[model samples]
Target: MSATVFAGALFAGPVLAGPLRANANDVPLADIPALVLPALGETLIMVGIVMAVVVVVGVPLGAIIHNLARDGLFPNPSLHSALSWIVSVGRSLPFLILMVAIIPFTRLLTGTNIGIAAAVVPMSVAGIAFFTRIVENSLRSVPPSLVKVAKSSGGSSFQIIRTAQLGEAVPSLIGGLTINTIAMIEYSAIAGTIGAGGIGYVAITYGYQRFDNQVMLATIIILVALVAAVQVIGDALVRLTTPHSSTASDRRFARKVARLDIESANAASPV
Candidate 1:
């Protein structure tokens, strides 16, 4: 069993022993990073590549799809509906199924179906589909009057999309982007079934197979922290991009406080 397990180490992560000993149940916490860091790096690289492709392809694809709607500047209902259905199909499939089903395509593109390169193809497909909708929804949220203004000023269709639609939708798009990114990170882990290197591989090998409670616990913690950090950063960017992301009541209270401060100063001054 031990030899057979080591033989399939490609699916599992590197066997840590010689200098960096990891004993799942009995290993020192310090040695866990040796096993986990490389996995984390793989996850990051996979997600990063997927997002870059999503942004490059999905953003424009979304813009094109949205602009084909009856209410859009171009207004082509047939094209819009067809594109919409296509995107819907992409989103409807579960990621795991998407990965497995697309193995042939993945192999055709990457020339191998057992590494980060193979993982990227399915992830990119799913992510592009997911984010195209996000971009569309974000663009939809833009006020119609913004489009009207752009048109009334003699803006071209492309200009309207760039300056009026996408530019105005920055905050919402960022929020959607943040959500998509976290989802892709999860997909990368699920991509582990193909022997894609990531935190998921670590969990399966060290935690699940080896019964390494400590390593499993660490993976969980790291996953949570990674997600929280993305959310925090994304929220910060959204707030920064928005003109006045604060509540109306907050603004009103601030004005009231300023007024009171002025009154108090006047009262304190001599006649």
Candidate 2:
């Protein structure tokens, strides 16, 4: 009898509990694209805005944090500690909890807390914290000898950082940017669950609540493809930026290669 009932439950999933098939509101598979595409665009816009903010703010902030350390160009223990603690606090909370926790702040800033604009606040906060660490780590991977050489050459602080530090770390930074962008895509979905509007909203409203298997499957496929495409593009960029071998000469050659690639790319591309 137990076996029979389990079989019945399995059957019920598609034949009974999935009453979406019986409902007048059931969406066809062909129409799933129509609904998901707009949501995808919204997700893209959300991630794009957050990434712009993350890059503009995260790079400088990461540089400041990195430079505050003992070995950094400028050491400030107090300021470093404060900033590190703040980033830690931001990283500690899960995105869902963070979203709820920052509702008042979001509303205060955006004057509302239920749209894409409202969602950008927490997303930017989380993205900035994550990308800042990525930038710091990438810069750390640069050889200290490079900085010394720059200083000996009479390079100014900003010049030393821009050339000896960030320039050498470009590949790692690109990889990190890819990871951060993917993360924001996920956050956009989470934001959608709370009515922030995106692919996540479609999944929640049509896929789960309505038990629409078609919409559920479509969203899953689209998300998988989107992520895969991003990963592929990111991996290619990383390869294009990375040195052929781990040697100073090889690194210089890689920079030349990257420069050529950059020249061919559209303007405003990352260095």
lDDT of the candidates, in the order given: 0.87, 0.86
Taking the tens digit of each residue's C-alpha lDDT, what string does model 2 give over 145-214? Answer: 9999999999998999999999999888999999999999899989987798888889889888887766
Q: Tell me each candidate's TM-score.
A: 0.82, 0.83
> What residue pairs clash in candidate 2, if any at all?
none
Q: What is the C-alpha RMSD of each candidate to the true structure, in Å?
A: 7.9, 9.5
Residue 103 error for model 2, in Å? 1.3
Expressed as tens digits, the lDDT of each residue in 1-271 for candidate 1 is 2332343453544664322233435446668889888889888898999999999999999999999998888989998999999899999999999999999999999899988999999999999999999999999999999999999999999999999999999999999999999999899888877788899778877777776667777788888888899999999899878877796656987999999999999999956
**Model 1: residues with Cα > 4 Å off, grouped in runs:** 1-27, 247-271
TM-score of 2: 0.83
Off by over 4 Å in 2: 1-10, 13-23, 245-271
Residue 70 alpha-carbon offset, candidate 2, angstroms: 0.9
TM-score of 1: 0.82
